[model samples]
Target: MSTYLIGDIHGCYDELQAILEQVNFDSFMDTLWLTGDLVARGPRSLEVLRLIRKLGDSVRIVLGNHDLHLLAVYAGIVRNQLKDSTTLLLEAPDADDLMNWLRCQPVLQVDNQNKMVMAHAGITPQWNIDTALQCAREVEAVLRSDSYPILLNTMYEDMPNHHHWSEELSGLARLRFSTNVFTRMRYCFPNGQLDMICKDMPNKAPEPLRPWFTLPSLIAENYSIIFGHWASILGNATPEGIYGLDTGCCWGGELTLLCWEDKKFIRIPYAGIKHW
Candidate 1:
């Protein structure tokens, strides 16, 4: 049995399908681990969601920032930003089903047997695998509950410089930070301060802000984390147990797939630019 970990799909269903076809995916013998951002910015968001849903237990997705935003928008908690491009999903006949499936995804996924942890972004230097899992479950519970709206209402914005996982924090906001840390996080200050506004690669980051992958911590040194969402830098590359799957499929870059067991990579060239 082979386990393939795919980077951020971002609704590039055609590229996803082509990559899967090239890999000769077999539902009976293969498992797919997706590093979130399963929808948005590209065409065919609905198709991507449907294909994953159809695959069922054969696939697992760690929630991405885009996925969380979709849930928030669908729940009437947040609106899209200016660059939003998920009209295909909104118009899909199964939009409700797509949203439901997305909300069910976890923020952190780990295969202890393989010692591989997957998230949309990188785990904080402060969090070990266990702490990360616990926090992810906490937020997952709220996202899955009927009070999801209340949680969503409080979900946006950056968190306190130092987060301690408090019960007083809104569940949606909790989800937001967790999502940010695991999926959207790129750089943080040396003392473990997150700088959310910086989107450049670590080399160009202002002094004191180090890439999460380079943090000198037990989690960084101990576990193998497979993540996407930082397409501008580590595109379709695997280095030192860190895999970046988001080859900027939405931005005319390739869509990459990595086979977990062997670390083999496959890529499908971007077809064209998508306006919405």
Candidate 2:
């Protein structure tokens, strides 16, 4: 059975289907790993969620920033934006089941046998694999618990901005930092502090800032890391063992799927569907 790692879909259901077909993905045989942002921006958010949810055990997903935002909007903790295409998903008859399924998803997935780790964004440089796993479980517990709305309500702010992880960090502050690292981080200072403002490609980014993967980390030294979120990179080559899969399919680029056994990338260009 082949294992395929797909970049962010962002609600581009048609493109997702096309790429899966192109790869001859078999739900019963091949395993599909998604880099989240499963809904938003593009058309048919509802359909995309439904299809992935139906895939069940064959699919593995880590929640993206957009997926969290969609949950917040569904929980009435935040308002849906005009540019977002998730309203249909929020209003769907199976919205509750879908949201619950999403809430139960983790922020980090590790395949020890393959020595690979997947997160929506890259793992923080400050944390080792064990620490990252612990932090992910911390957030996942809250998300799967009755207190999930509390996290959804308080996680929107970027606190301790541009700061590194601290042992002293506790309560919601700690959870928020972990959440950002797993789902929103892009650039970080050489000292391992996060820099949330810059989204430019590495060369264009101002001095003292480097992509998170460039920073020294125990995790990177070991497992191969697969992530999405930074669509601006357009699937450009990154440091060895680091994979950036988001190719901006929702913004008129291609949807990318990495074939794990052979490390082949199968791309399906956007069909130019108008933004919702």
Tens digits of lDDT, candidate 2, 101-218? 9999999999998889999998988888899999999999999998999988877776555256887888888888888888899989888888878888899999999998877887
TM-score of each: 0.90, 0.96
- Cα lDDT tens digits, model 1, 178-220, are 6567656877777666678788766677887778777765563
lDDT of 2 at 179: 87
Best by lDDT: 2
lDDT of 1: 0.77
The residue ranges of model 1 lying beyond 4 angstroms of the native Cα positions read 80-83, 159-176, 220-222, 236-239, 274-276
